[model samples]
Target chain A: GAGVSQSPRYKVAKRGQDVALRCDPISGHVSLFWYQQALGQGPEFLTYFQNEAQLDKSGLPSDRFFAERPEGSVSTLKIQRTQQEDSAVYLCASSESGRSYNEQFFGPGTRLTVL
Target chain B: GESVGLHLPTLSVQEGDNSIINCAYSNSASDYFIWYKQESGKGPQFIIDIRSNMDKRQGQRVTVLLNKTVKHLSLQIAATQPGDSAVYFCAERGKGAQKLVFGQGTRLTINP
Candidate 1:
């Protein structure tokens, strides 16, 4: 079975530019999550979606970070006015259900480099 | 203020030897813990998980031990192989929380 997939494995952006990262979760997965991982650090949760509903966005660092899963299958994370501090790998994951105990299948993240 | 942290930044073990990675979490409300392995240029891969109610759980060659009283967790891998060389992370999910708090990660090197 195909696992989660993300686009633009690497991206370079100028300061103040906006960037968008996409994620395709596994087929029939009901839960999706986004996380940000800085260099040499573990991933930190960014947002979560259960189907098309955006349940939690607490981990998003700032208002510039926005995410949506409008169709319930694909999700996107967008950062406005990118900054050096926003440079990190954005990871996407999905699980069979919304329960915390379920194993989350992750995708090869998109590494964003802000200059 | 809540965070998961690793005691060691790196660990090196010989091939066929066992390896242990330790983690400490500050949140006492954490009820679910998971271990993940990550290679260069990839996302974290789910290794194993254990709940607070259970003291230990095993899967394949990996075992996860959770000590709620001490707010500690550990992951043990038997017969470490070259393929096991990567960064390992411990994550915790607090009760009623949807997000997972991850540790800094411990780099494991397997010397053959």
Candidate 2:
């Protein structure tokens, strides 16, 4: 793809319902990341994957939030039993390498509204 | 929590004025830093980047300044236009997974 792409730009889920967001990274991107951005706040890291291996997920916020990047290409962030507090924009980014100095391209983001 | 531009610094400049936005990061081990421009209801667009070893780097219409001693970073935009009006953010990459930690951000409003 030309850039990191996300699906279903906006989502409205009921409490206790499950919602899934997808990400398709640029071709040959080795590192992928997910973040959550609350209203009037900066984006916070959620999880990281390097070529299909989940490395750092310490920032997932809770057990209900999970992300996976299988085959090092596409990724998915699934939230189980969504809560009202979970309403926010979920962002996905991809970088060419797993190095720190590399630039991570970001997607448009999925705005999840938990009602 | 540590904040970047908690009150949202405002920069109202003429269309051709050169705008400078500053940021202060806490970590010293952060080698990767980037400037992002986010418009309303859109994703962040990369502006420019600078490595830890370098103090300054320039792009098409943007420049980034890094001061390791004070952990400060600044972005200089040349010939600001109305389209440049947006919130700018500076992000630092983590140690292991290289996850990005973003600053609070500064809102730039270019006056016509």
Candidate 3:
């Protein structure tokens, strides 16, 4: 079975530029999550989706960070006007259900570098 | 705001030795806890989890113990192998919460 997969594993964006990170969760997964991890730090929650509906976005750091899972499968995390402070590894995870008890399978993550 | 934190930033252990990693959380409302292992350049991989109701849970070569009284959690790995070398994190999920709060990770180094 394929685990969660993310595209553009490495991204280098100029300051003020916009970037989009994509994630493809395993087939039939009903819950999807996004996280941001800084150097030598654990991943922090960013957003969560159950199917196509984004039920939680409270963890999003700012307005520049936006995520969408329109079709209930593929998800995209967009950072508008990327800043140096936004540089980090963006991770995607998925689970069989939206329940907190379900184990989340994670993708390798997209490493974003702001220059 | 409540947060989860580790007592140590790093731990070095020899192969075949048992290892214990500790974490402290500030939120008593958190009802679920999980441990994750992350290798370099990769996302976290789930290892084990325990609910607040149970004080302990055991997995293959791994044990997770929860102390609701002190808001503490610990992960014990028996006969640690080189593959076990990675950054470990403890995450907490409050009741009815959809997201998990992760603590600063503890890096485990294995000596062959």
Candidate 4:
């Protein structure tokens, strides 16, 4: 079975540029999640979706960070006007259900570098 | 604000020996806890998880122990192998919460 996968495994964006990171979760997964990880740090929750509905966006740092999972499958995390602070690895995870008990399978992640 | 933290930033253990990593969480309301192992350039991989109701859970060579009284969690890996070398994180989810609160992480090194 294919695990969660992210595209543009490595992205180098100039400051003030816009970047879009994509994630494809495991087939039939009902819950998807996004997280941001800084160097030598654990991943921080960014957003969550159950199907096509955006359930939680509380972890999003600012308005520049937006995510969409339209049609309930592929997800995109877009950062507008990327800043130096936006440089980090963006991780995507999926689980079989929305319940917290299920294990979350994670993608390799997109390493975004803001120059 | 809720936070999860590990006691040690790194640990080194000889191969075939048992290894233990500890984490402390501030949120007593957290009802679910999980451990993850992440290799360089890769996302976190789930290791084991324990609910608030149970104090311990085991999977293969890994064991997770939770102490609700002290808000502590520990992961024990028996007969540690080189493949076990990676950064380990402890994450907690509060009741009815969809997001996971993660700790800084502890790097484990398995020595030959």
TM-score of candidate 1 against the unseen true structure: 0.98
Which 10-residue span in candidate 3 chain B carries the lowest summed lDDT? B93-102
For residues B1-112, write the lDDT of model 2, one tens digit per residue: 4334323467788999999999888777777788999887887889998878799999988999998897889999999989999989888764543878898788899998
What is each candidate's DockQ, to 2 decimals?
0.83, 0.69, 0.86, 0.86
lDDT of 1 by residue, A6-51 (tens): 9989999999999999999999999999999999999999999999
Pairs with backbone N, CA or C atoms under 3 Å apart (clashes), candidate 4? none
lDDT of 4 by residue, B1-112 (tens): 9999999999999999999999999999999999999999999999999999999999999999999999999999999999999999999999988888999999999999
The DockQ of predicted model 4 stands at 0.86
Ranking by lDDT: 4, 3, 1, 2
Model no. 1, DockQ? 0.83
lDDT of 2 by residue, A1-115 (tens): 3999999899999999999999999899999999998986779889999999999898998999989887889999999999999999998999999877788899999999999
Question: Chain B TM-score of all predictions, in order?
Answer: 0.98, 0.90, 0.99, 0.99
Q: Is candidate 2 or candidate 4 better by DockQ?
A: 4
Tell how far residue A88 is off in model 2, in angstroms. 0.9
**Candidate 4 docking: what grade?**
high
- Which wins on TM-score, candidate 1 or candidate 4? 4
| Candidate 1 wrongly placed segments (more than 4 Å) | none
- Candidate 4 chain B weakest lDDT stretch, 10 residues: B92-101
For model 1, residues B1-112, the per-residue Cα lDDT tens digits are 9999999999999999999999999999898999999999988999999888899999999999998888999999999999999999999998877788999999999999
What's model 4's lDDT at B47?
91
CAPRI-wise, candidate 3 is high
